[model samples]
Target: MSLKSERRGIHVDQSELLCKKGCGYYGNSAWQGYCSKCWREEYQKARQKQIQEDWELAERLQREEEAAAYGSTAQAPPGAQPLTFSKFEEKKTNEKSRKVTTVKKFFGASRPGAKKVLGGKRRGDAPEAKSGSPSISRQVSLETDRVSKDFVEFLKPFQKPGQDLYKQCKIFLEHMHHKRELSIEEQSEYAQDFYQSVAEKLQTRWKVSPEKVEKAMDQVEKYVMTRLYKYVFCPETTEDEKKDLAVQRRIRALHWVTPQMLCVPVNEEIPEVSDVVVKAITDIIEMDSKRVPREKLCCVTSCSKHIFTAIRTSKEEPASADDFLPTLIYIVLKGNPPRLQSNLQYITRFCNPSRLMSGEDGYYFTNLCCAVAFIEKLDAQSLNLSQEEFDRYMSGQSGPSSSTSSSSLLPRGRESSCPEGSALALVRHNLEAVGQLSRRQERVEREARRLERDLIEWTEGLGREVRGLVQRCPLRLHPGTPASGTPAAPAVAIDSDNLEDPRLPPPLQPQVYAG
Candidate 1:
């Protein structure tokens, strides 16, 4: 119905203006013919509720689909009722019926009235098996089996001296599969330990010579190392995931020791080198220098130094080779050191510095630091020059322009006017004596202070005990009171012969003054 508004004198349709929910309120244009506030809110609530219901329905349908797809419906209690998937169950039943029907069809076709074929071949024209010729597929399978057997036999020598070869191979392969989880050194140590244990067992059980056992151990280690290197780094093998997994899981190498693993970094900050580590390595190289080439050792040492320096900037463990790869690549690419640049390809291909420096325990870095400290101590022992003078000498900073000779840094005194060599010796001796005296004085002072503190504590403890005893005594011996049941107090006595007693001091003596 059209109504006239008195305020504006405008005609409006009452039915069109009214709220659709019958709220008895005029609808606003903003609400699209519904009450603006309440109807909009109710509409939003309805939409949200519908959306929630749809989402829940979708999730339930997905779960049911997954359950049906996997074909296992026993989800709840020990003996819950099976859920029904009518279409799926029907399909399965139809498949069974179809298979049965096909079998029956085959039997029916074999009836007496049906056309008979010779030897199960249609029309007696099918290809006949030739007795003398093997199929290509059969030949390939036979060849593969033969190769595998031959390979196993080839690896027999690499097994521990007296253990079952097959069993040892299995264990080694399993170890290789998990070896990447540990650092290269740890893996080497483990392999070495295994070799040692096996060798010892064989030595005791088989009465094998120590030298023979060592030789066997070396062969096994070498085989393992070569095999591991090939398996891990080979281009054709490494990319094939299935082959790689199989190799890691089942392939065993005897034990390989590359030059990189054995290389030790040089001391840069100290004049004296580590005698023990350097000497051991030198001895090995001298004994069998061909096995560990000097060039390879040098390259390994250089690469190790670079990696150690690179990682020192960050305390976080490097997650991959990429972390330091860029820096090393830059160094090689820059070509400032022409030799290193020329040999960069060979170094990268053969020597993996990342593997060497990746020890979780930081043994390589620790060893390098120890070597440097040892060298520094040795230089201090032998060199007469001060640290600054030594530094200048090493850096060529004390050339013709510099007035300070190595001996000029010697202690200045009447001894300074002596001959250079003699003065240096004298100064060194004096410094050494002074250092020793200072150390000895510090120790003596410390001992004296400790002794004093102990004496004080002991005296205080004794004083407390004496005071306690005197306070607890009941023999007061007062002149005014008669001594009843209590025994008479002893008279104070002094022993002149024992004047050295610790308790003889007048201040420490207990008073027996009558009140």
Candidate 2:
């Protein structure tokens, strides 16, 4: 069979590509068969464990080396040294051995009655691993179940009041899940109302403290949202996904906007500033990887802080809102974070209303929203550039060339017959001149600084040499009498004008003349 025919014959199942942890999200091979959120958690766990193991290994190696060196230095026979024992040392030794044994059991290495099964199947008579020791996934699942059960048990003291609230929340979630006709706005309003009602009940009926009421509300939100995330997030009923794509495309087109153009203080050439900018971009891009509203909001906050920090480092002063907003816009333009619109909408619709109303988080999120809006509606007027120039950039024809300028290419007082056809040729000519001028200015600045430094160094060296020459070969002059006992001649001052050429050096004064 032909290669094309063989390729067409292959079939792949979508279910096989689902997350191995059974989160219902599509999986990626690079993420080790998990979705982005799950992979992030797994990676953090693995990294932490790796660091701990590395530390332990280093300590072990150091101890072994110290022991070897000590043994070598102690050349006396074994019986020459007196044996000593202390209760503390014995206790420590026993504890160390116990820890080692526990670690082995935890890893299934020393588990009692554990058996290996053949062909990936358990034999009828084979013993099972202990329930206390489970795989990572199993442990996570068990921990989640434990937390849920504990929460239920905690609410049990509240009696029928908590049970009724819980049942109402479940019913509301079920109704929202099945009702495809409900808009996001309606659902959000309903959710907010339900949350407020729960909060009031917790405070009034249950007589819970104000402090505890917020915590109870948070738990309720988490419980409700965890179940509704798949249905509500980036649903097809809304235009969030389409807006995300549009914003992404717009950001990509504006990639030529440098930090200078945005009036942002960041300079990517500086190592510190570059690192901060990169981190800001990374955090912004990670916003969509999160599944929860609060987590997404946190990502925005983190990204904004990084941008602000970069601005502060670049300017060497605390950045104001003006500086922060521009820098954030520049970061978004550079990052082109995925699902920008969807993530924003998700946070707006699902995050707590109080959080979005007032607070530091709200302020930063509002700025981000403004930055995205500005980017989406960007034009020639917004950038302080001509329409022709903006269009040329958007069309990817803003490179330097040796052709005629844009103005000259067009007829006087009239538009060109074929604007698009002539745009590349005309725009390139103007851009070429601007590019050359900018490069020349940069080169001049660099040369000027170099010349200034060299001049300062040369002048210092000349001063030092002159001082040394004067000290080595001193000229003695008597103010009242001449050495020859003749009448002292008046000191002569050299006139600069007496030089033949204006650029020539003036005559030197007589050194031995009487004062």
The local lDDT score (0 to 100) that residue 107 gets in candidate 1 is: 14
lDDT of 1 by residue, 1-515 (tens): 22222222122343544555676554432233344334445545655666676566556655666676556554466575555567655655565445323221221122222334446433212232431245843663465456446546554664554345346645885787676444322344455456545666657865668766655444444334333432233222112233334323221110121111112122222323233223333322232111211233344355445454534423234423223322222222222222221122222222222222233212222222222222223221123335674455445555322123222334446345655466466566678879999999999999999999999999999999989966654233334334685655553434433456575564334577898
lDDT of 1: 0.40
How far off is residue 507 in model 1, in Å?
99
Worst 10 residues of 1 by lDDT: 251-260
Q: Candidate 2: which stretches are off by over 4 Å?
A: 1-165, 399-515
lDDT score for residue 42 of model 2? 67
Model 1 misplacement above 4 A: 1-170, 228-373, 376-381, 399-515
lDDT of 2 by residue, 370-450 (tens): 677667777766655578978998899983222222343344443344345456645655577789999999999999999
TM-score of each: 0.23, 0.49
